[model samples]
Target: MSTQPRTAVVIGGGITGLATAALLAREGLEVTVLEKQPETGGRAGSWETGGFRFDTGPSWYLMPEVFDHFFRLLGTSAAEQLQLVKLDPGYRVLFEGQTGPVDIAATREENIALFDSLEPGAGQRLEEYLESSEEVYAMAKKRFLYSTFASFLPLLRPDVLRRGPRLARLLLEPLSSFVAKRFTDPRIRQILGYPAVFLGSSPFTTPSMYHLMSRLDLADGVLYPMGGFHRIVSVIGDLAQAEGARVITGAEVTSIRTEVSGRKTRATGVQYRSPDGTLESLDADLVVSAADLHHTETELLPLELQTYPEKYWQRRVPGPGGLLLHLGVQGTLPQLQHHTLLFTEDWKANFEKIFGKDTSVPDPASLYVCRPSATDPDAAPEGHENLFVLVPVPSDPSLGAGGIDGAGDPRIEKMADAVIAQISSWAGIPDLAERIIIRRTVGPQDFVTDLNSWRGTLLGPAHILKQSAFFRGSNASRKVDGLLYAGGSTLPGIGLPMCLISAELILKRLRGDTGTEALPEPAPWSATADSRPESAGRAAGGDAKPLPAEPSSGDGA
Candidate 1:
């Protein structure tokens, strides 16, 4: 509100923090991003070892429109900074006892044909499902995803009222129920129901409202960046700095200092440990925490300023943690695709184990295997392959807290070995284990130490009915007047797109711009009907090593 430069300190150099710092700097505020890791990107970060590069967290670029819209806001486009390659068969879903895996194609006709061959009338029904999903995606983008829950007025809007019935059904109806009502085939149901894992819920429990994920993956199709997933991070960081935002990686904010005036307690600055282990402090007019929400509230802010205590978080269900294995093998594994999902025959049992109170990992577990070398040869040395495997594991208090130190835990190594062996058998590579030249594992302990993730959850909180929308953590602090929250833990919830949207929502609230128009404007290229990207090939990886946080680990990949 002042003509002079208002300094703002943003904790965490993750996607949300970087985006927020850029936007705020563009608005003439002096913004500084404080990231604990040596590099930014949080879970979306990447690391390289033994000439093999691996994206630490998210690899699938499902929501292309979201990324494009973000760059457009920076006065540029993704095409300018990143060469995105569209995966023709978006991904492969393999089932136990099946000789051949089902490839989900980018084109509707190909997918329809694949569905029809498996089940009669299923092809047409698949189209119907996606059609409904498309409508839901559009509606959600307008009325929910891009909007914040700062007021109750938006719920009374004309468009929201008009779709009240449809919204109610989707909100109340389970995804499994919705799919079963339409298709009789079990395989068809499994295929349609798989996207629920992306939001950290089982199809049997997740609301049908989340079926919009199908539109993002099946209809819009999945994509890969030119040089692994970290390219997006490098590009965004450049743009943020170009916009006049200063970045200080390896500076971990230990405490958010506050000043009290009358009854108001406002955040004034922060004390952080610099990369060299020296203590330092930075004064600011406002503090935006894009770090782990729990860590920010319980550790960074004082006890009195804490709004959601440990008990508050304990009651809310958290998304799954991950058992990750990054491998550099001696030879190529032609049986695998760039993006592969190995589904369990008894998927519900796997879900039970994940959500169950027991600390046991799932048996015959569902897993996601990402072979970066499948698309980019440079990801590995000649004739070798770089594989990143992820299995959904429990992140309850019973599990070990995730971090670099916990990465070498014997239990984690044992679990990783079992999962890798299972993947080898499924991929028809009997000697896969023998070919592994380099290996690393990340488990619950790694998540806790790296990102200070509550319960070591990779995707923040579970997107259950009670935790959805306004029920989720607030971006604006309830007690700390000048502090705000961002990232997957806060409003709009989970996924990289949601992180970007969270930044925009926080910016609007800070600027007092409280209208539907506050949402991100569509990129000029994205407005076209046939904006499907061409398949471009390139090398993937860099010298950066894995960071503290990991990607969206709860998603069934």
Candidate 2:
């Protein structure tokens, strides 16, 4: 091993890779990031068309502390680089057969009241539920979220021992059962349970440890970058370069170079094809892949260097692949809010269609609609609207390409029309189709081809109990020395916040440090006059049903 500064090459230029490159450079390592795309943002990349701008992936902004911590490490903050706006009534939920929509308020009190309106005394119960959730979140951040299985010290910590019993219960119980046991109203159960979908599993299968996402929402609140969520990507990229890290876009890594002596094999660097059609090799002491985990294992490394083979990947439960539509309408949509979740009444069957044996596009699929123009007028042309609609489906390339011979199953056009019709009918925008000036559809095929994602999954692997934390793929490789992994597929799991934490964990592994990094906390947020009590009416959308039977599968963004 060299005593001088080491060089590192990071594959994939998404948030995770960029953050890792920046952190490594700050730690005195020469770092280089290679992205196959023309842009460095990966899924966070944006495009302009028809006088509108669209963020390709990851629109929701939760866990503000994670981003703030990452930026602060680069000697800056998200606030300094990108203006952030706190969303009041963070998002709206439109349930099937409901006259009014459920607006999940940003304030703790409002959320409590929102729960109480659904069932008497539910407000107090929510307070208790969140209090427990807060404890779990705090402990998780200190113990599991920031630390890796690189050491057993985490298991011996006083806090971990103290909370062991409770943590066990959380890990053992399914999120669906946990919420159903606490809240009587079906909507309350649905609201609390829906977040588990973001982790890429059915509420019935995912552990209740994920309830921390609710605290991240109700207590911490949701935020958006002033420009768009993609701005965070650019901000992080700039910070990485400012820290002396070099980022090379349009460079597709072909293989991770390795050397073997006797019984030991070690990764030394990577070989990639440049945009100018030349194959180039870069030497490094270490190589980290923040790209799709499956692609890295199956394609980038030699078969002998591969830790998890094709069969291993085949057995893994992947997160949902998305069916997305980006639209530029000639007129404004008055009925839609900045963030809207339109859920169907047959929630069980809907989920079954995604992760269950049936695994197909749901007939009456639940949808998520993001109208960035509702918050930032610059997103669209004057008097026009920009809408990004997403529907979670099974992660399968065959389904992505509309099945075999392109005629086997739900055709992309048919699916898009169904989604549009659902949105038009639900939002009361009857002429939605006619007003569309620019329309783009992204299916499973897009994910598989564009990002080389496993099964065209929008998110990474599903966070089933078996695929979480210590059980999840390690950030550091087990079979190869000097090779590591990051991103949604790796430990500390999915989403942008998780990606930032993934970077931190990777740092800990590389440095062999057991102590957690002390990043500054997020700025205090509170409800303002606009978030006054009863803003959405005492029972703006108060209605309930009994908890439905647990479904075999579920999916969400």
Candidate 3:
């Protein structure tokens, strides 16, 4: 290796890719980020039409701590970077057969009361559940979420060893069964289990370990970064450039260039097609593929260079895809909150259909709806609403892609029409379809064509126990030197927070650091400045500002 200055090339400019570029640049490595889309953000991107701005990806802003940690690493904070609105009654739930929607208040008391109203004595059970959820979350945030898992010994520490039995039980029990054991009212059970969908699995399949997700919303409250998640993307993109990293959009990485020398194989750089229709190559000391993991392995590298080859993926289960709708409504929606979840009466059957051996879209689907205009006025024009809807379905690319107007694939448009009618009737908005002046549909095939998503899975691999935490795909390429991975497809599971942590994992792997804790707040970072992050550390005392604690918080869409 020629040593002048270390350089890194990051593939895909989605949230993880962008975050990786900024972190790598801050580490003093020259960095370049390539994004295939015209814009960055990947699944977290947004769309604008009819004077309305609809967030296309990741509508919820859960895990405030993760957001803060990522920004602090970049010498900033979420509060300093984005306009966040802490939603009151974090979100509302509309269970089938219910006369009206039940609000999930940020305060424990209100939430307890809401649970009690649904089923008597359920209030006390909720308190116990949240307390347990908090405990599990505290344990997970440290040992698992930030873990490199390079050593199983760190998890053998006394504190963790003591919880071994409990941890095993958590891993063994299904989240749906766990909730059902506590709350008899199906609505209460569904409320507790619904978070699994956001994690890209059905509750019945997801282990009880993920009950920690409930602590985010039912306890902490929900936040929406104004201007949508794309704003966060732009902020990270800007930070990368500010740190001297080059972010190139409309650049499609065709292949990761590699060479075999002596006995070892290593990634030297990548070849990509430029916007002007020319093939370009960039040489780097290291390369990080933050694109879809399966695509990177199966398509970007030769069979011999592939780490997780096609045969490896054949045994894996893909996450659920989405039937998404972005609609600009003509008038206000009184029945819906900023975040609304309409649960189907047959929650078990609904999930079965979505994640079954022969998967299909659920007819009486348990769907999520986001009306951003309720929180951010700028989301819509006057007297208008920007509604983002998601109904989980099979991750089969054959289901077909989405389109504008009523022009999507027949199967996709049919689902959209049915969902529109369902939501209109359930929410008591008879004219909902007619009031939709602008509509956009995104189906499973959209994920395939637009994102190179394996099996059109919207969130990568499902968070089943086997596919989670230590068992998840490794971030570093085992056979290729100077190659790494980040994003949902790798270790630590799904969602925006996990994506950010995946980037941190890349940083750790590069530094040969195996400690499983958030890196300390580095003293003012700069491009080409490779000073050790001031340690001893922010956990004890540092001049870094305190992380903001909001309405005790949460978002999933």
> Which digits, one per residue and each the tens of the lDDT, describe model 1 over residues 508-528?
777765555345554354545
Clashes of each: 11, 0, 6
**Residue-by-residue lDDT tens digits, candidate 3, 117-193:** 99999999999999999999999987889988877777877878899999999999999999989999878888899
lDDT of each: 0.78, 0.79, 0.84
Ranking by lDDT: 3, 2, 1
Badly placed stretches (over 4 Å) of model 3 are 1-5, 523-557
Please provide, for model 2 over 232-253, each residue's C-alpha lDDT reduced to its tens digit, 9 standing for 90 to 100. Answer: 8767766666556777777889
Off by over 4 Å in 2: 1-5, 401-410, 516-557
Summed over model 3, clashes come to: 6
TM-score of each: 0.91, 0.90, 0.93
Better of 1 and 3 by TM-score: 3
TM-score for candidate 3, please give it. Answer: 0.93
Ten-residue region with minimum lDDT total, candidate 1: 534-543
Highest-scoring model, lDDT? 3
